[model samples]
Target: MVGRTLTAVAKLSTVPAWVRRPLPAVAGVEDFLLRLYRRTESAEALAGFIALSWLGGEAADGPLLWAAPPEERFARAFLAVADALAEGESYPPPEWWRAEAGCLAPMTEAQWNERAGSWPERFYAHGVVCALGWVLGVFDDPAIMAPLHCGDGRSVGYGPREEWRVRLRACAVPLHLRNEEIAEWLRSGAGSQSGPAAVGAARATPSRSTG
Candidate 1:
């Protein structure tokens, strides 16, 4: 399921080139989050983060643009999926508010920069990796068995908290090795490449269940 999601995201060719670049700047993070929030607003709140990380690969650059013709197209896709899950119920929070709440924490520019610096290049890159891990963790969780089993339902679950923490560590690899080749980096102390394609390729390979 996780591999399928990553493949689906990687197939989106219309995502802007700038959005595809692996820069770790704050602007990049904000842009990615904003676009993700805009598209997934009507969907699950957690979906925004998932959408960003799932679609926004390590190579994505600039603000995330949808492969769909108009922004509404992408928005509708997300809304349809989200609405189906809601089962005729309204989303608890407006999409924008949910995005703002989930993404925007009260951190000063200096703090963001400091954190970004602690990362390989910047915080945006770190966020991208974190977002991916978060998505994977949610998928691996056992509590939300319904979402995994059923196609669409109101019981969409976000997975276990412990799993999320472990996934976060896995996703932080690119951020920690910005200067190195992605394919050559080691994750969980195992050697892997630092390139985006390497990461994508890794997703396709079967490994022991992290859960």
Candidate 2:
């Protein structure tokens, strides 16, 4: 059965085959991620895994994945994976999510399109993380939300896994804080900055293993 499985995996298309291919040196890493995925109930986790597979096992920003402490690294990777799955779309102003007193007004659709078109991924990442912020109870705006594609096996759609939602609930730093950092990145107009630099921040707390 193991041999048959390996053979089947080997015959997949280039991208999927690369994603499913064994990493002998990182076998434990692979196993742990797969096990976590199997046990996870979070649609975000499934979305992250789908993004990971599509990325061919690398973060969207590549080496930046290792630049942060473990907790930040994990959360950023989550953000990265989530960012990858973001379907391109206009995003509302951060104020919409914060719903704070005297916050800036949400952008009009035309305004959002103009700004978002200049840096689509930044806007996309922002929307994705904001939606995640909603999930983490960090934000309150549901009026404008991003849609994601969570590919399950061979089918592509968005929905929670039937069994559990344990993953992404325990990000290293408080998820709200991390979500704010990404929001700040957009608010600051740091589009000229590189992906890692724009998204990176000093560790909010000491690093710890999520594994």
TM-score of each: 0.23, 0.21
Q: What lDDT tens digits, residue by residue, belong to model 2 across residues 96-173? A: 324421222333576545534533333334444543343333444322232232213222233432111222222222
lDDT of each: 0.33, 0.34
lDDT accuracy of residue 112 in candidate 1 = 33
The candidate 2 region of ten consecutive residues with least summed lDDT is 1-10
Q: Model 1 — which ten-residue stretch has the worst lDDT?
A: 142-151
Write candidate 1's Cα lDDT for 61-166 as tens digits.
2112222222333333333323222242222344643453233222344543443343222222322333332333423421221111111223224553344334
lDDT measured at residue 7 in model 1 versus the true structure, 0 to 100: 22
Q: Clash pairs of candidate 2?
A: 41-164, 41-165
Task: Give the top-scoring candidate (TM-score).
Answer: 1
- In model 2, the Cα lDDT at residue 29 comes to 24
